[model samples]
Target: MEFGYHHSSFATHDDRSPAAALVDRAQRLEDDGFEWLSLMDHLWQLPFHGHRDEAFVECYSGLSAVAAVTDEITLSALVTCVHYRNPVYLAKVVSSLDALSEGRAVLGIGAGWYEDEYDAMDMEFPPADERIRQLRDAIQLCETVWTEDSPASYDGEYYDVDDLYLNPKPDDIPVLVGGGGEQLTLRLTAEYADWWNLPGVTPEEYDHKLSVLREHCENAGRDYDEIETTVTIPTIIRDDTDAAHEVYEDLLEETDEDTTPRDEFRGLIGTPAEVAAGIEEYQALDVDRFQIGVPKNDPETIDRFVDDVMGEF
Candidate 1:
């Protein structure tokens, strides 16, 4: 399986800056054995475990900073929200970032979630139905901007742009989408997304989603296996703590839904053997990529993942 490190960028009250710790994690992800690194995109800071707004980093700026320091691992937004920005500008930004990283970038997109984030920031968070349409249009726009030399024009209910030009197109950059919505989302993913990421979902759910995706692909006249399957699992690997299993269990209780995201991954609990066994279970569901998150950003957890779980894999 292709392995990647995923973390929420948060500030700690005790000491040091969020940027330093984030860089530390990215550097270690490369130093150890991860193929890629991803960070979530958000406008307003949400409530973390304890501190609400102290430690979160701006998504685009931090990602650029990470690209500046790392060369071994690919960098990407875990999933950029569709309703978050203008499609044309974001297309340019994504293409530029891919070029800057020498083609080591993935564009992961999603229909927007978290209404509070939009409401508080005074951005329009359209209803789910409209958001799906918006996502489709955004993908169309991004693809056009990347592949076309002449000005691109698009007309949709949610998006209408004319004669927009982008230069220095990226080479072989992939667009990933996160969702399993059977109607628009999965169909669009089958049609466009290079990777389909399922977050904090059970192997059964993942299998079900993949089934739906396959059906969508069939309907769309696309190959079922063309879009790769990825898993973003909330993980905790404790090197030498009696708290190994409990950490995963308690993390859900402590962190809020908006911040922690995808609360269903509590199965990351248990001993290394048990977690490894669980990983195998997930692998059985045909996961192409696994982006596992470390609890508390502990170096030992990273070591445990590389030494115990990934080593066995």
Candidate 2:
């Protein structure tokens, strides 16, 4: 399976600036056989992952800068929140990035979550059902904007556009929908997305979702094999499993309690060999790609994972 690096943390030392650091990391990832580099699209960090008040970078702008620095790795947001920007405007942003990257751009998107971010930004946070509806409309609108000639008009339940004109359109830009709602989300994925991202689900759960997705694809009269399957999980890799657990513990908040076998962890946290085994389990379920969110800005874990785990796969 191809490996993708998700930039979930923003940590920089005195030796380099954040922008320089990202460039270096991006180059290293490309050299190390990572196929894609995705950045978190949220305006503020999520509390479950990091401090909400911590440093955060805008997604598309950062992607443009990264496109200038790296040539091989495809650049995208881990999953852009659909509610944050107008559907047509998002198409414009992604098309601009695709042009900048010379067609090395993919759009990973989802219905908006993290109500706190929306409230903080004074943006409306609709109910989950409504949000998903908007996501569906946005996907349709994006396709219209990207593929159709300009001066178009689209009227959907949630998103309506008049005389929508998009120039410098991307050449068949791929959309990867991120979510695993067995009903609406999976149906939408089967109907609209080029890729389906399952975040933090176990191998068994992933297998079940694949089944559900296939059923949706059949109902929609679409080929299930056409949609690439990807899974994103936080990975902590070290030379020793115990050392990795120590790092995991350190990363936990004060109120969090440690559990045996790291039950508190939702993703792989162990030595390179152990992590490779975990990936093999997922591979057995027919997962096509893995996007790992390595906490902090620790480059050593990424290097170790590539040298040890990725080589085995």
Candidates in order: C-alpha RMSD to true structure: 2.9, 2.1
Scored by Cα lDDT, where does model 2 land? 0.83
139-217 per-residue lDDT for model 2 (tens digits)? 8888887887888778888788888778887788899999999988999999999988987778888899999999999
Residue 184, model 1: Cα distance from true site in angstroms = 3.0
Question: How close is every model to the real structure, measured as TM-score?
Answer: 0.90, 0.94
Count of backbone collisions within predicted model 1: 1
Candidate lDDT (C-alpha), each:
0.76, 0.83
Write out the backbone clash pairs for model 1.
Answer: 11-55
Alpha carbon deviation, residue 143, candidate 2 (Å): 0.7
- Find the candidate with the highest lDDT and give its number: 2
Query: Model 2, residue 260: displacement in angstroms?
Result: 10
Report the Cα lDDT for residue 86, model 2.
76
Q: What is the lDDT of residue 114 in candidate 2?
A: 79
TM-score of 1: 0.90
Alpha-carbon deviation at 76 in model 2, angstroms:
1.5
